[model samples]
Target: MRWRDTDKSSNIEDRRDQQMASAGVPSALLMRLLPFLLRTKIGRIVLLLGGAYLAFQYFTGGYSLEPSNTSGFSQSQSASNGQLQDENAQFVAAILGTTETVWNQLLKGRYVDPKLVLYRNMTSTGCGMGQAQSGPFYCPADSKVYIDLSFLEELKKLGAPGDFAFAYVIAHEVGHHVQNLLGTNAKVRQAQQATDKVGANQLSVGLELQADCYAGVWGHYVDKQLNLLEAGDVDEGIAAASAVGDDRLQKMAGRAVQPEAFTHGSSAQRIKWFKVGFASGDIASCNTFTAK
Candidate 1:
């Protein structure tokens, strides 16, 4: 929570000023190439790395990939004020910087820094069109994390208010980047594609819970090495994990809480895994895939 004076990450891409008018539709060439690339084992790498580069360039105004005759978009400046001094943006950058430090030490020089993209309303990403409603996500294709500052307001609405809670969210997304580095995301995606809906949901829950544990692993480092956590910070983080549980969100929406429908695990499972990583400070202990 002591982030105001902390260093901010230079890897942050500020796209708040660039308003994406249409959902980023890929160029025809890219759409045709991706499927072909995804078919082979080695090609998956090219698919993620190369496809992402072309997609990012197309979406971020490198060139107009769409035809001029298409009715999809027009150029216009963002109406939202995209200021650097915005307190929330600074907080996000500082947390990202902290994650960079933790991950560098943890990965031991193998870590390539992932940029965090800050956008307002909607944006184009390597994955696809990013909307605020999707919350924060790590797009492994581009090696970036996409977030809308407005998501903090939504987090507060979910009863997870506190700077540490927000930090946990950033760390969780960064955790996904870690998974991407470890090839966990790719394995899960492969498994998901081959499984039934319920089985795929189970795989998703493991993936998400592992990310939660990774977040706790980062928390462990910050508390032990950096000495940044104050009293009750862990509680705030657990509250955040609880607030975003599949069961909790389903209940909030007044839907029947179905275990089969859960994608991010139950509240107890999330809290448990986070504690596991926090207690151990070891990534090896975060094997949610094999845990009961």
Candidate 2:
């Protein structure tokens, strides 16, 4: 991918230096003790006292709930990490800027650029606490995308490597932002609410496939308009899409290929949809909801 020459996006929120912390008591520990606390009078008293103590501490600023730089690292190690993070941040910003350009042009003034946040380990989002284990995700509630760059390493481990592959991942998340902007996400949520588990999963599969298609649409423009793609770049994007396919992942986990359990469709489905959008470069042709 020819991204270094591209302009970096101004919408990036870098929170990689910070880590979320609990105040007074950890929420997980409190939840674990809740049932015991409610079962006995002494436990209830203890719980009440604990709650009062926490409240007093909070009011007096005895503990902080804000994200803090708590990493205990040597200066050399910190410097090294900082350098790598800076490079990765620049790459992310460039890709996001390309997406913003394409979407803004396509939407013709209706597109709102979504904020992309770079964090390490975990971060607080509009959708609640986002963990690195969950990979990258877009939170519609905040109109932002949260990503832990470690997932890029994870993608390499999943057999998809290269800059374009990473760009596809970012584009896919941005595709979800487009869905949110066009009200497609809300409509899908409403439809999901009206369906059973299997039906809901099917809707989820459709939604995910649509995002893949949208990513391909973005890829088409970037390659055609900006000349960002090089040899084998498209293959990397396809491999990245296939790497996370529901069926392929389930098979990797030694499970049966159950279409009913799929929330992101099969590898073939993903590749097909991506190709559909890439081939046509048309949003109308990318609709997976009504496709057979």
Candidate 3:
């Protein structure tokens, strides 16, 4: 990916692996937030099991993540801020700075940089208890991005590759940030609150698909302006889009593919949207609502 020497995103918040290992999360908030996730006994069991698994990982080595340059990080994979100093952190922030430049120029407005928070196990966010299990997410409340560096390895295992894949993930989250800025997320949330289960799921699919498109838009200029993409970079992104499709995840989970249960689009839809934004590099072209 040639990322070791390239400009890192200023928005990045790498905590480094060793320090993250020291930051074991507690369970009090999980108990408090249990009510939001379920109403049934079986659901509660699932939640408890997930929490226990996260706890085990926090203390052990599951959450360990290192930076792209792993010269000093050897204790674990978790990106720990305590063990890592400001230099590594700047590497991430530099990458984010590039994203801000690309997206701002693309969007033609002052780019509001989302603070990419680097934490171990769990951290306080404007949203509810932020944990590694939630994967990488954007909190609209505070306009911040969250991620666990261990998930970089997870992405590779899932078939998403290279630094571009990481950039795609960030851009996709930033896409959600774009939706928040454009009031698309609020509109979707409002419509969801007003609708039944299936209709709301449809809205979610649209929203997620649009984020894929937004990521592609970021990819377009990133290649044009920075010359960062090598051959097969775009293909890697397509592979990633396919990898995270609801259908693929469902099959991996050993569940029957239920279209209604899809929060993210199918493999075809995700790839199509990302490609749409990539080829066009126009925000207006990412109107999944109209296309649908």
Best by TM-score: 2
- Cα-lDDT of candidate 3: 0.75
Q: Write the per-residue lDDT of candidate 3 for residues 116-163, one digit (tens) a residue.
A: 876556655678557877778889998988877666777889989776
lDDT of 1 by residue, 197-225 (tens): 99999999999999999999999998998
lDDT of 2 by residue, 1-292 (tens): 8888887787777677664444645555776788989999999999888778766775687733354455532211212223434678788888998999999999997999988888777666778668888999999999999899999899999999989889999999999999999999999999999999999999999999999999999999999999999999999999999999999899899999999999999989999998888887888887899999
In order, what lDDT does every prediction score?
Answer: 0.83, 0.85, 0.75
TM-score of 1: 0.80
Candidates sorted by TM-score, best first: 2, 1, 3
The best candidate in terms of lDDT: 2
Evaluate residue 100 in candidate 1 and report its C-alpha lDDT on the 0 to 100 scale: 94
Model 3, residue 52: distance off in Å is 19
Model 2 misplaced regions, further than 4 Å: 24-85
